[model samples]
Target: MEYIDPHLHMVSRTTDDYETLARMGCVAISEPAFWAGFDRGSVESFRDYFRQLTDFEPKRAAQYGISHYTWLCINAKEAENVTLSREVIAMIPEFLDAKNVLGIGEIGLNKNTRNEATIFLEHLDLAVKYNQQILIHTPHLEDKYQGTRMILDMLMGDSRINRSRVLVDHVEEHTIEHVLENGFWAGMTLYPVSKCTPQRAVDMIERYGPERLMANSAGDWGPSKPTAIPDLIMEMKKRGHSKELIRRVVYENPKTFFSQSKPFVHG
Candidate 1:
């Protein structure tokens, strides 16, 4: 049962993650540009970060038979500084043309502030201009509900963009319905502490019926588990989910989403 983790920060992961994922049947991943595990001082910082995604990480994944692709963009938490965010967004197109580059992503509201909203709109515009699929990271905890609503409203208001071309990520029980109902691709992060657990992800799939939706580990520079994706797959199988349904949710959905970008190649 091969899988595609559509949203992870593999740049922050260890080689062991690659090895484990390959052994667990992860064949490909789309690592999105995130907050660098901290705030960066300048655009040069982001420049170097993006290089690691396009250059270093792919080499690491290749050694373990996991094809690595990246979604390049400034993270919403860091996008509050408009100047730096703009600079990073400008640099994204150059990388978007790279071989393993997939799309512009993980770029929605963080704290749900005015600045975050402004940057998110800019990201949406850039994605539309580049004809790239957009991957959004909604806020977490108490902010999750409001942020998800705002992100959906803005996407709806933007007539130039297509909801189907966007993946609204990090959804929970509270946010998943709006995301699915709005005709957007839904992504549930399989994290132990901060996001959906593997069991909950399976429950959501059962309830939602796996249409235009996918799940990822979102493993990154925190106390996050990299094995969450494979765990979800295992649990889903154990629960007697049909192979076709499991394949569509865990493998085919991400492939179809990232396939919108010509640079992405699935083995």
Candidate 2:
């Protein structure tokens, strides 16, 4: 079954990974700006990275017949530098009009610090002013719960935010309901380690019934799998899920959420 991995860092993967993804039925993907394993020192570094995301990565994905969409932001980990974060956020608009550009995102709390929250709200303001959709990254492991709540509260406090246009990703059993019940879309990122596994993702699907929910591999430079969504598809089938139901979560749900972005043209 053809599908879309809504969140993956192709910049960290090889060309072989792209070929493998295409072979496994990944028709398209959306890559959000994330920390490049370290804190960048200047706004120029981010400017160059945005150019790579908007200009270079799309061309690379096209070589394998995979459409690439991207989100632009400084990422939460780097948000600690308030001055640098603001500079990067101000520079993001230059790429917002790019055909493959989606919006300002993967922009939530990391350690849930004051600076991160300030930057998160600033990114929110940028998205609202530009009428763009958002993709958020909640903190990991022990920090996930409180970080997710902090991110949710900030979003809820904003009257200008259109709930349907925002996606809070990396949700687990503990945080999924909070995201969906409040009317925003939720993304379950399947990973080999740390995040939800294929079986667990299927369980969440069973419990939630698939409305406003989607799954992704979130393949990055770490120990992750680019084909984890296919793993979820296989697990769903093994558990006797109908093909239509599987298709809705893996394919249709992402399409529906992304269609809200002007740059995303459904094929």
Measured over all alpha carbons after superposition, the RMSD of each candidate to the real structure, in angstroms, is 1.1, 0.6
Worst 10 residues of 1 by lDDT: 258-267
* TM values, all candidates: 0.97, 0.99
- For each candidate in the order shown, give its overall lDDT on alpha carbons: 0.89, 0.95
Per residue, candidate 1 scores C-alpha lDDT tens digits across 157-245 of 99998887888999999999999998999999998777999899999998988899899999998888887887887898899988898
Error of 1 at 129 (Å): 1.4
What are the runs in model 2 whose C-alpha is more than 4 Å off? none
Q: Identify the leading candidate in terms of lDDT.
A: 2
**TM-score for model 2?**
0.99
What local lDDT score does residue 251 receive in model 2, on the 0 to 100 scale?
A: 91
Model 2 CA RMSD to the hidden true structure, in angstroms = 0.6
